[model samples]
Target: MNKKDSIKACGRTINYEIVYSKKRNKASIVISPDLKVEFRAPHGISSETIRKMVSEKAEWIQKKLEWFEVNRLPDHKKQYCEGEIYLYLGREYPLKIIAFDDVKEPIVSVKDSELNFVVPKKDSEDTLPLLIKKAVWNFYSKRAEEEVEKVLKVYSKKLGIAPPTFKVKHQKRRWGSCSADNVLRINFQLVMAPPEQLEYVVVHELCHVIEKNHSARFWKLVKQMMPDYEEYRKSLKKEGWKYML
Candidate 1:
């Protein structure tokens, strides 16, 4: 049988699918030229033990992924122009931009496999592009507010803690964070990832309500809420370049 699992390695989450064989004696990690990670192992090994072993070797795995990243251009890079492919909920959607001065806010919606974007105004030649890009981003942040809140509510109950005040916003390098004052801040770009990936971030932040740091207890609490969360985290990291505007 094949199983999906994740390990925190080199301060990054590495998700891999594992194949079990009764005859195999040693577990090995295989990295495809395209950077997909797979593990082959003997049967009857506990997941925690496997995770520990993988974590020990995570530095190597992380370096391999980085090597591939450095050697190749990012996959699905976006230009924020018409005909560009965009992602939402892990699905691809082509971008379609329209400008209107009548509206006060940028409007973005998905319909018929298109990311329909409406800008607040049609500006002068040079400024229009920047305006549209900013507007499109704002649309993402707004939608994140709606979508992320629903997930936070669901996981909040599962964790048996009152959902704290949270906001969807931009972070230059971080995905999500929980403040010392008990507020949760999620990345707006996360809405473009798959639902499970988004759920993982929400659960990760919500768990902070109980465990303030990424200590052993914090990870244990996270694992309790989502056993496959590391897989999602790894996935998000892998395809993250394609998901942003």
Candidate 2:
């Protein structure tokens, strides 16, 4: 079952939806890439309880909404041109294009302080940028999967929860999301941030598998897993530009 509603957070009105699930043991809030807030709760959960939960998380929700509103971009300097800057792990890496005759397909790699793109001189001249873009996307997507797996292993063990299943994808507004089944969807762009930022997002989603809401207990679990999470959270908020596809 599903129903729509609205509430005020940080003196601003926020529209949301409630999705009822008979199999769900706890309630969770998922903010989509379009900034649509959703509440997934058990069939017997009350509207007042959900509303109170939303109200309790008003500040964080408002900040996320505002960040999404401010950070939407159609293009992010991904021209794949020579010397153009790209980020990896919160550091800058300049683009270096190498044209070779034997190269049949685009290949991208990070060597030292540059993102090396190798391409064929004949076939890919017209579609060089697109090829480079795809290569870069694959690069980050693979690294994101690895990073999520590694982080979840260490942190989930500390939190005493088995490593939950996760996926890496491109999302415009969200860093990561925790689904009702304890599955996590991590944004691939997140691999560009510093290591601590990635850990914070992973830990935040992992905590949701237990607490399910942004209540005090959920935050406490996050803190337990990452004692300096607040610093990384604030830094991520300020470095929001680094999280781009």
Candidate 3:
């Protein structure tokens, strides 16, 4: 079951959703990327108990909400049209939409400091945005494939370990993760970030193969690989949302 509720925190009433699940053994609270708060609790948990738990976690929840507020992507209702700026490798480039009569599918390319979108003339203005979004995704996915592979190869060789298979996809809450089988999954949105930031994420996840947790030893390995990793990591938190299309 799902229900909407609100809790008082920091002299304000913060709205949230409650989900009751049989699979859950305890209560868990999460602040979504969009700043929506959610609480999942096991069956038979009382509302008062849940409210008390939320009160206990009120400070932490407020901190997360503030972080999201500061880091959220500006212009969430951005229309994919000409003159709109997009990020590539930490640089902003204006988008140029070019309608072509003979083009069968949307094609996106970067040339001379501009992102060009070649779309069929038959597509309506409403449909053009969707097509442009698809084109942009394709462009990022291709770059992710090339750039992530190169970084992984270099780091794997330096670390003297077999490189794990990696793939890029959309992720809501994580930059990258290492699976139990040692496979690496990178967020393709990161392709828009600077190369150094991308490399930092790669090395951080690669260190997970040696140490599964973010303990001192795991961070030690990460520092050994990239001495400036902490700076890059903080930058990811501060300005990473600019890359989200």
Candidate 4:
């Protein structure tokens, strides 16, 4: 069963949904990518207990909500038109489109601080947006593949562990994750971020290969790798929206 509810967090009313699950042995709370909050509890838990748990977690929940509010992407879709700014390596580059009748395939390149897209003249106006998006994604994916490999090699030597295999993927909510099998998956969107931030994520997931949970030992290892990782994490949260497209 599920029902909607509201709670007070830092004197603000935050709404969430409550789901009663027979299979759940303990209560859990989750904040979705769209910033929707949900509380899942075992069937026999009391409403009062649930409210207490939410209240106890109020500060953490408020921080997450604030982060989402600051970093959430714009509601409207991107048109990928001229003069639109795109992120690459933490810098902004304007997009420039060129049409050529002799061109057989669309080509995307970066020169003079601009992301240049050259395409067939006939399809430039009608299909440019889609083509530009695909081109941009391909560029990011390739960059992520190359950069992650380099960062992993550097950190693997320092950590004294075998380098884990990694792949670039499109992910909505997470920047990167490491599986129990030691495979690391990085969100291709990260290629748009600063190189230091990307390295921080790589180091973070590499530590997870040693410690599966975020225990004190895990963070200790992370601090050893990058003492300023906290700053990079906060920067990632604040500047993440620019790379969302």
Candidate 5:
């Protein structure tokens, strides 16, 4: 028989498999689709030991699923209308659609912290919304570059590593990441967050220069730079809806 077999644990039948890896120093239990549990063990670890570990940690695995369900991103089906409030950086602003003449294309302008989008007076609200999205993309792309540079310079000196090139993207699940090749990619959605949170993410990615993985030491480095990062990290979870339009 294959290593994978059905076993009952915690009043539930867990379909699982065992695999060995040379790079793994510890046994890890991964729950796969159809609720199949996989035990990834270090080379030479016994199957019996792996099974015992899985049985013992069944509660923890269930907790992980509970947490995932609780924190899953909400469906983004919010309806947008005229004069709705939106935020960029730390400031709040009302969405204003400025009407134009002569069939001019829509444009966005910022004056004294207020954002205004130019659309023909006769244009449809649908057109205005599309223009606003395009303008937001352009505006945040430039701002993201500037803000990233500001935070990178501070952490690069503290970590004693050269700053790497950065790219701005609209990432789905991550706020930022640093690759092994030293490229730093930041999510443009951060433009919707407050300035302090954005800076925290920057420092978080910059700390990856010293440690690639999310090890304890990596978080220690982040704490050294931003002492209250734990609070900010929780804030990201609590106020996640505010960051979306």
Candidate 6:
């Protein structure tokens, strides 16, 4: 079953809906079209706590019915365009779309620190968007892999831990994940985020090799490596999600 169907409420496996507002940065629980329960503070709150908090405020749920109505743009469907700015390694670069006939595959080029998208003529404009996106993603994915290798070399040497096998994936809900088998999965879309964000994601997952959960000890290790991680986390919410199409 889906998450919505799996969650239970008030001793009943009732359908629970989550309502969020970017302006408020808060989440509210609503029961179908009937009721809404607002959580005043949801930052860093886990799902179970959210559910329990909602249950405690079940009485005001009906009163906040209007908040249940919300509309949001579909994730990462925004089209890439020339002059549109993107972040790479904490720096902003303007997108320059170049139409050329000599190149067979879409290529992303950086010269004097300016980024450009070079595409062949055979690819139709209708398909150009996807091509450009793919080209960019591939470029960044390779870069992320390379960066991971370099960072792992440095950290492993310092920590006296060897680099372990890791997989690269494009996760919609998370930047990275680690399995019980010690296999690390890094998100490919992370290449679109700033440099510090990308580094945090990699290190965060690597730390998971030692501590599987986000307990205080895990964060302590992360902070030892990256003291500015909280800023990076907040930065991801601001613009990092745009990486995936």
Query: lDDT of each structure?
Result: 0.81, 0.86, 0.88, 0.86, 0.74, 0.67
The candidate, 1 or 4, that scores higher on TM-score is: 4
Pairs clashing within candidate 3? none
Candidate 5 residue pairs that clash: none
Model 2, 112-151: lDDT tens per residue? 7898988888854668778888989999999889999999
lDDT of 6 by residue, 111-226 (tens): 55667998887878788778877887777778778777776676556556788787677675468877887777888767667778777788888888787776899899888877
lDDT of 1 by residue, 1-245 (tens): 88899977677889988878664678888875467788889998888888888888899999999988778655543567777877788888888877787977667788988998777664555765676687778878888898888987888888777789998887744688888788999989988898898889989989988888678998999999999988998997787665556
TM-score against truth, every candidate? 0.66, 0.71, 0.80, 0.76, 0.67, 0.68
Those runs of model 6 whose alpha carbons end farther than 4 Å from true positions after fitting are 6-54, 57-76, 237-245
The true-structure Cα RMSD of candidate 1 reads 11.5
The residue-level lDDT of candidate 3 at 137 comes to 92
Find the candidate with the highest TM-score and give its number.
3
Clashes of each: 0, 0, 0, 0, 0, 0
Candidate 1, run of 10 with poorest lDDT: 72-81
Candidates 1 and 2 compared by lDDT, better number = 2
What lDDT score is found at residue 177 in candidate 3?
89
List residue ranges in candidate 4 displaced over 4 A.
Answer: 1-35, 38-77
The better-scoring model by TM-score among 3 and 4 is 3
Which residue pairs clash in candidate 2? none
Please state the error at residue 59 of candidate 2 in Å. 19
Error of 2 at 75 (Å): 6.6
Clashing residue pairs, candidate 1? Answer: none
Clashing pairs in 4: none
Candidate achieving higher lDDT, 2 or 5? 2
Q: How far is candidate 6 from the true structure (C-alpha RMSD, Å)?
A: 7.8
lDDT by residue for model 3 (1-245), tens? 78888887898888888889664667899886688898988889888888888889999999999998998745655588899988888888899999889999999988989999999999999888888988899999999889999999999998999889999999966799888789999999898899999999999999989888768999999999999999999998877767777
